[model samples]
Target: MQPLDKSVYGPFQLYYDHALEMWCKDPANAGKQMSLHSVPQMVSYAFQKAFTPAKILPGFKSTGIYPMDRNIFPDHKFMPTYSADRPAPIPNRDEPASDSDSERRHTATTSPAPSKLDTFTSLKEIRPFPKAPARTEGPKKRKAVMSAILTSTPEKLSSQTVTISAAGPSKPKKLHYDADDDEGSQQCSGKTFGWNK
Candidate 1:
């Protein structure tokens, strides 16, 4: 066939070459795919194909399988089982009485010694130890002494008096003239010249 185009089929060519190489060297992988259980057989086939007595790398040899020892698989060892059946310990139930009970008993026994009447009698009997005598005379005695002094003085009269006299009667004087004088002339003169004229 004509040469394939390098620009279009370059990556496909490389993949096909690698698959052919794997198929040729691995006898256990008789075809393109193999199962997980056949990995040891495949590794054995690859070692024999890729390595020889003359072509072996330094410090390397064909051991016929991967990891060379069976202990490398963790599932090869044994594991112990666990249980959740054991129960927790329980607390104790019995205990003794406390000191508060004794204190309450003592208080209840000593609460009734003093009554109300006993307290009142004790207060009334608490007077002063010694007493003093009483006096008899006071302000009334002084008042009696003053009254006796005022009544003992004597009574005296005054010498001055006011007198009134009765009024006397007024008397008329008797007039006497010369017995020989002319009475008619005196009358006529008095009547005519003095009174009538």
Candidate 2:
């Protein structure tokens, strides 16, 4: 393998590359490299070798390879064997029990008795809530406002003061009343005397 660049993550990069090679060589052993039991030791080794924190590794971040799980090796006991014909051990029924069992039994027995509510057939029905009293302020206040609006007088139009003068009296023609009145009165008397004679 080419020598890793001596950068901040150089050692971690080398270890990661070695781990990857090991993983590629045997995928089954990959679990062992990352198992819970071996991760701390593996991380310690990596730290001593000057590897950067595992979380910052390109492969670890991209592949989500946790340091702990990566180092953990699976226990062989947990694997299932199809050919092994081993029967599971049966539970023992004759084991001595404690007072809690007796209490549990008593509670179970008493709990099954029918309650008074079990025999009840009918329940009092709930009545709908009465509508809230109509708002008193609404109609009364509306009528008062309407009446006040109807009775009020419209505002008067504004007036302005203008200066005006009285017109001069018309001149009258002088009547010749003295001559006309004397002549008319004499003619009326003459006519009245002739009619009477």
Candidate 3:
């Protein structure tokens, strides 16, 4: 029998009705009409079978709810991404234009004549940045820096420097081997061979 409590029966009425329909329409029961007396029993049996605990256990495990493991979902689930690189759709060029739209197109195509500001030549006058002060100070400082770097010499380098170590100046090492040295000569002649003494 359907539960008398709306809280219990209200949510289940749709499922119960569906199961009753299936049961009543079964091929085995075809041509045999089910009386009102048999509907509640059939609906109750079908609903119980549909929601059995055995059938629902796997669902809970797949969703990682029973043991609460978050890694059950596969890595590829986070890999799909939206791409903005696709080619834009082709626009329809054969549209039937209305009077207003054609007027707008004509107006947009034939632009107004250039003003005095637009026709003015940029080369005639320098338009320095409004935020910058008179560039006189900057050029003077830059000129001084350039002159100092270009004219710098060893004397200038030594003026600001202090000698840490006065180890007498070192000479570059000379090459040990010359073209006159024989290729077959022993590098250490004092070490004699076993029988060559």
Per TM-score, the best of the predicted structures is 3
lDDT, residue 144, model 1: 39
The C-alpha stretches of model 3 lying farther than 4 A from their native spots are 1-39, 78-197
Tens digits of per-residue lDDT, candidate 3, 9-45, equal: 3435666777778876789888887788887786686
The top-ranked prediction according to lDDT is 3
Q: lDDT by residue for model 2 over 1-197, one digit each (tens)?
A: 11223233666767756655655478567546455765565556666666445434544433334342433335564555778756767887797777998899989998897766755544444555567887665543433332324333442211111111233454775534232343343233224212221
- The Cα local distance difference test for each model comes to 0.44, 0.50, 0.59
Candidate 3 pairs with clashing backbones: none
TM-score of 1: 0.14
- Model 3 residue 24 CA deviation (Å) reads 4.7
Candidate 2 regions off by >4 Å?
1-6, 23-33, 51-197
TM-score for candidate 2, please give it. 0.17
Candidate 1: global Cα-lDDT? 0.44
When summed lDDT is taken over every stretch of 10 residues in candidate 3, the lowest stretch is: 1-10
